[model samples]
Target: MIAISDPIRIEPWNFAPERSNFPTRNLPNRRAEIAREKQLTTLIRENNRSRRTCASKIAEMAKKAGIEVKPLEIEFIAARAGIAIS
Candidate 1:
């Protein structure tokens, strides 16, 4: 009897173009650059809010990880801690 074999398959990944083959992105205009910088500065400036109370242990852990975390509402705290579940 003839042997049964799987048919050949075409994987799109094998034919994908390399990123280096694309042209480099153009730099943003001065106005856009200034806006982006300003937005980033605002985000960093408003990052800390000492409203909710965080656990001492959790705060210490965050500090050791180079992240200054203040306890938010329990919901927010749970969300943040969920990120470290792994």
Candidate 2:
């Protein structure tokens, strides 16, 4: 529950399989972005997929299609679609 200017991901504890420690909780004064983040996280949990997994899949698929997508861009696209792609 802390404010962070940039996104900081926290891994789930070994003992807590159902939770993760996300450091970036909110923006300075952007409620909309915060809400979207919350929603996106929820969607990720529901899908039972990790950010890395989604990003890798995206990259691989794009590469196969000769799109040459970058990691950062892939992650951003996944996030917008409610995917937890790092």
Candidate 3:
């Protein structure tokens, strides 16, 4: 084994958690940008139910109103509306 003049090139790779190669399953939700979130928050507050129930109800409402919303976004909206959705 003798390699005095090898034409091999190698580069060091830095691992960054924020800039990973894998793509996220869900896209970023417009939590504050959506105007209807306020209304949805109100609805969530009006209903006296658990987190899962509220999420399902809000999803149904959003579906009926032809609005695209996710369960996580609902939690954010509820929090922004000053409602404890824990």
Q: Which candidate is the best by lDDT?
A: 3
- Choose the strongest candidate by TM-score: 3
- Per-model TM-score on C-alpha atoms: 0.25, 0.33, 0.43
Candidate 1 lDDT, tens digit per residue, 1-86? 75569677776643544322333432345455556445433333233244332344444555565755553422344453342211
Question: How would the candidate models be sorted by lDDT, starting from the highest?
Answer: 3, 2, 1
Q: Residue 82 lDDT in model 1? A: 42
The 10 consecutive residues of candidate 2 with the worst lDDT sum are: 18-27
- TM-score head-to-head 2 vs 3, winner: 3
TM-score, predicted candidate 2 vs. hidden true structure: 0.33
Instruction: After superposing candidate 1 on the true structure, give the runs of residues whose Cα lies further than 4 Å from its correct spot.
Output: 1-28, 49-86
True-vs-predicted CA distance for residue 57, candidate 1, Å: 18
Scored by lDDT, model 2 comes in at: 0.54
Worst 10 residues of 3 by lDDT: 22-31
**By TM-score, how accurate is candidate 1?**
0.25
CA-lDDT, candidates in order: 0.42, 0.54, 0.64
Give candidate 2's total backbone clashes: 1
lDDT of 3 by residue, 11-79 (tens): 535354443443342223343345476677666776636554666567667777777778788777777
lDDT of 2 by residue, 11-44 (tens): 6464464323543443333566566556444544
Cα deviation of 84, candidate 2, in Å:
2.7
Cα lDDT of candidate 1 equals 0.42
Which scores better on TM-score, 1 or 2? 2
Error of 2 at 73 (Å): 0.7
Clashing residue pairs found in predicted model 3: none
